[model samples]
Target: MNLHETTVVLVAAKTATLAFGSALTYLSYSAFRRTDSRALRALTIGIALLTLGVLLGGVLHQFADITLEASVSVQSVFTAVGFAVMTYSLFVDIIDEPDRTRSGARTGD
Candidate 1:
């Protein structure tokens, strides 16, 4: 009910969201490596949602003036990086798929 309690709740929620996003990103990457269709799709969606969640959480925390401690910031940065990588992987996969592009080229190639 108090400001501190509210901030603590938000921080905990953000942490959990970031952890789940990281797990999804990792699983998706693993699936892509193994050439699993389900895993790849899961990863794409998971990473996308995770990215959104991270952005939203960061914004919310900033607006609320909540300090997520130094460790959380580190974890958040890593999570953001992971999300970026996964997103890039998904983009590449989509662009590289023969059905998705003409001559399988990603422009200017």
Candidate 2:
């Protein structure tokens, strides 16, 4: 693709990622209010990080061709880390919630 096209694609990707991140943040906040669970909070944070990674990936792709040599290597690294952490937190949150609820029920009984 042409440089212009590539740049456009990168910009679009970045915008979309950022938007998604914002939405996730909002949803997480809502969930937090409704559930007051740490797992939900962690999951929300992870979603935010994932969104950030997407944003950084887009930026890195766009900067790859610029004359200014604006490298996205660091951003890419952070993105990967963020994705990993977020994914892990999300998984933990998913798995832990059921156990927490079950324990609470057993205690009540």
Candidate 3:
């Protein structure tokens, strides 16, 4: 199809994918909260940040006349920060002593 049409299709696909990812992450966050998993809370935040960033960029592009380069830069920051949060969270463990049972040991998660 035409360039404009192709761009629209691509953007729609990207938004759908991001939305789906965000939904999954939010579900994970809820699950983590149920068990009060401290280490994994940061993972939820990271996912949220990335999701919001992607959505913000998409909305801006579709509605506003902002430059493409500026939009990319703005969204990149969110993605970077999200990854950084996830890295820090995963690197730091909160368990002082491992809780185990006779059955398969659970992660307390």
Candidate 4:
């Protein structure tokens, strides 16, 4: 196939990917509400941000005024923020679990 056709195919694939990502983000948010877990809240934020990053990275570079490098940089930053949030969520959960386990045992659980 031609390069343009290939690019179109790739863009289609990305659109599908973003749609799936958005669904996951929605699921995370729903899970957060039911559980009220801080970790799940952070995870929801992370997924939302990461999906936004992916959207920006895919679309912003198409404009003539925006440089590809600048779009990539912004995308990288957003993705990094998402990952940082998720890492904090994981750490918070990890720290709480052991403490809860120990406390429960001591409290005669």
lDDT of 4: 0.84
Provide backbone clash counts, one per model: 0, 0, 0, 0
Which ten-residue region of model 3 has the weakest summed lDDT?
A: 94-103
TM-score of each: 0.45, 0.61, 0.75, 0.77
Q: Worst ten-residue run, lDDT, model 2?
A: 66-75
lDDT of candidate 2? 0.68
Q: List the residue pairs that clash in candidate 3.
A: none
Against the correct fold, how does model 3 do in TM-score? 0.75
Off by over 4 Å in 3: 94-109
For each candidate, the alpha-carbon lDDT, in order, equals 0.64, 0.68, 0.77, 0.84
lDDT (Cα, tens digit) per residue for candidate 3, span 6-83: 988979877786978689688869978897776578788888888877877777776787777777777889999989
Give the per-residue lDDT digits (tens) of candidate 2, residues 3-96.
9998788778778878978898789879988989776777777677667656655555555553323345555665667667666765675476
lDDT of 4 by residue, 6-78 (tens): 9799789768868987999999999999999999999989888888987898788876457868877887999
The full ranking of all candidates by lDDT, starting with the best, is: 4, 3, 2, 1
